[model samples]
Target: MRMVFRWYGEGNDTVTLRQIKQIPGVEGIVWALHDVPAGEEWPMDKIAAYKELADTYGLHLEVVESVNVHEDIKLGLPTRERYIDNYKKTIEKLASVGVKVVCYNFMPVFDWVRTDMHKELADGSTALFLEKAKIEAMDPRELVRAIAGNPDFTMPGWEPERLARLSELFDAYREVTEDDLRDNLRYFLEQIIPTAERCGIRMAIHPDDPPYSVFGLPRVVKHAADLRAILGFADSTANGITLCSGSLGVRQGNDIPAMAREFAGRIPFAHLRNVRVYENGDFIETSHRAEDGTVDMCGIVQALHETGFGGYARPDHGRHIWEEQCRPGYGLYDRALGIMYLWGIWDSLGRGKQTKREAFSV
Candidate 1:
């Protein structure tokens, strides 16, 4: 696996490229033009600048965390074709600068939901938390206000412009059932996957955060069957999935290791993190250690190794530790720790495989 780190950009992120360069085994940065809104073409100059900055740090800009899909495309509105064309252009631009994979999601209204951005853990550090009962009881508008209230950094999905018309968006999506959402996603993939293939960029859809519907919004990319169906929508290597352990692990039934093995060939990107699931359908992001969370970090890495995965991977959200006072989940300290833990497992597994091959050869 090729280790990558997510860097917001020059001024947007507290973690500098210099710091990222110091992290062992990290060879690239998963990035995007965050200032640009969805359904718009990314400025080539901006993309080039990002590439230039990464090159300065001796890092590759190959995997982009997201170039968000327009809500029109997800809603199947008449304007969706225009947005899809814009996405194609963006893909072409990114591919020109050597981007290999683009990670995005089709969750309507919200990309990822969390009841608390800094819910204190037993260890005194705070982590992103999802309280099912709180979510069910709170009005989505209020929830949006609460999530967007973070003064330190702007949350990706809770953009002010998007949340400003929350009621209208909810009303627009009221009739969009799960099946309808699936059809819309298929249409989107059919339109863009071919372009992605031509540009030598893989379009990897991130599974809906939490792997379930929230605030009555329809979510299509939440299960293994859902992932399989989407891959069937376009029978090309460009069509792929970004297997996120924390997101899919929230469901408990999603065998993350099995996904690493099953979708081995199609997966071009992965978000490796763990989550501690509670009995009441709630969860909190945890450390990368196997015992610290529910997911099998070792088995997942081993499965990727067995598949000979050469794709990009990164440590996802991390807890607030060492009084870092950074972004809610994107802090540098904990994620740096996560990288070491992941490298430990991945390197050990790789060494074991090499030893076996040498034994066979002898």
Candidate 2:
């Protein structure tokens, strides 16, 4: 596994490239042009600038967290064709700069939902938390205000421009169902996957944040069966999925390690993080250690190793520890710690396999 770190451009992120460079085993940054609006083609100059900056730090800019799919595309609006064309152009441009994987999602209205950005854990370190009951009871607009109100950093999915039309976006999706969303995604894949293949870039779709419909919005990429259907949509190496452990782990049913082993060849990107799930359906992000959360971190890494996964992986959504006061989930200390934990698991697995091979040979 090739480990990468997610850095939100120069000024946008509190964690600097210099700091990221200090993290052992991290060879690249998972990035995107955050200022670029959804559906618009990314500027080549800006893309080149990102590459240049990462070059100075000896980091590769191979994996892009997202070239966010526009709501028009997800809703199957007439204007989607224009956006799809723009997406194709973006892919070609990213390919020119040596990007191997482009991670995007098809979740409508919201990309990821959390009730609290800094829900305090028992250990005093805070992390992103989702209270299922709260989400069900609260108005989405109120939740939007809570998320977007933070002036310090822009949340990935809760962009101010997008949430400004929250009511309208909600109204637009009222008539759309899960099947309709799937068809729309299929159309999108049919249009773009070929371009991705030609560019030698795999288009990986991130699973829904909680692997469930939020605020009555239809979510197609949630479970293993959903993943199977999506891979069937375009039957190509370019068509892939980002196996996010924390996102799918909230639901006890998702066998994350099995999913990793099953979708081994198709997954070009992974977001490995842990989350503690409660009996009350609430969940909180935790350290990458398996004991700290419900997700089988070791098993997930073991499966990836067994599959000989050479794809890009990152420690996703770390806790806000040491009073870092950084992005809700994208803090430095915990993520770096998570990376070490992941490395420990991955290296041990490798050593174990080597020992077994030597014993068998003897």
Error of 2 at 46 (Å): 0.8
Tell me the tens digit of each residue's lDDT in model 1 across 1-362. Answer: 88999999987899999999888888999998888888899999999999999999889999997999889998999999899999999999999999999999999989999989899999999999999998888899888878888776878888788888889999999999999989999999999988999999999999999788788888888878999999999999999999999999999688888888889899999999999999889999999999999888888999998898989999999999999988889999999999999988987876735342221211
The number of the candidate with the highest lDDT is 2
| Model 1 spans with C-alpha error above 4 angstroms | 352-362
- How many angstroms is residue 245 displaced in model 1 relative to the true structure, after the best TM-score fit? 0.2
Q: What is the C-alpha lDDT of each candidate?
A: 0.91, 0.93
Q: List, residue by residue over 188-260, the lDDT tens digit for candidate 2.
A: 9999999999999999999999888888889888899999999999999999999999999998799999999
> Listing every candidate in turn, what is its Cα RMSD in Å to the true structure after a full C-alpha superposition?
3.6, 3.9
**For model 2, what is the alpha-carbon lDDT of residue 37?**
91
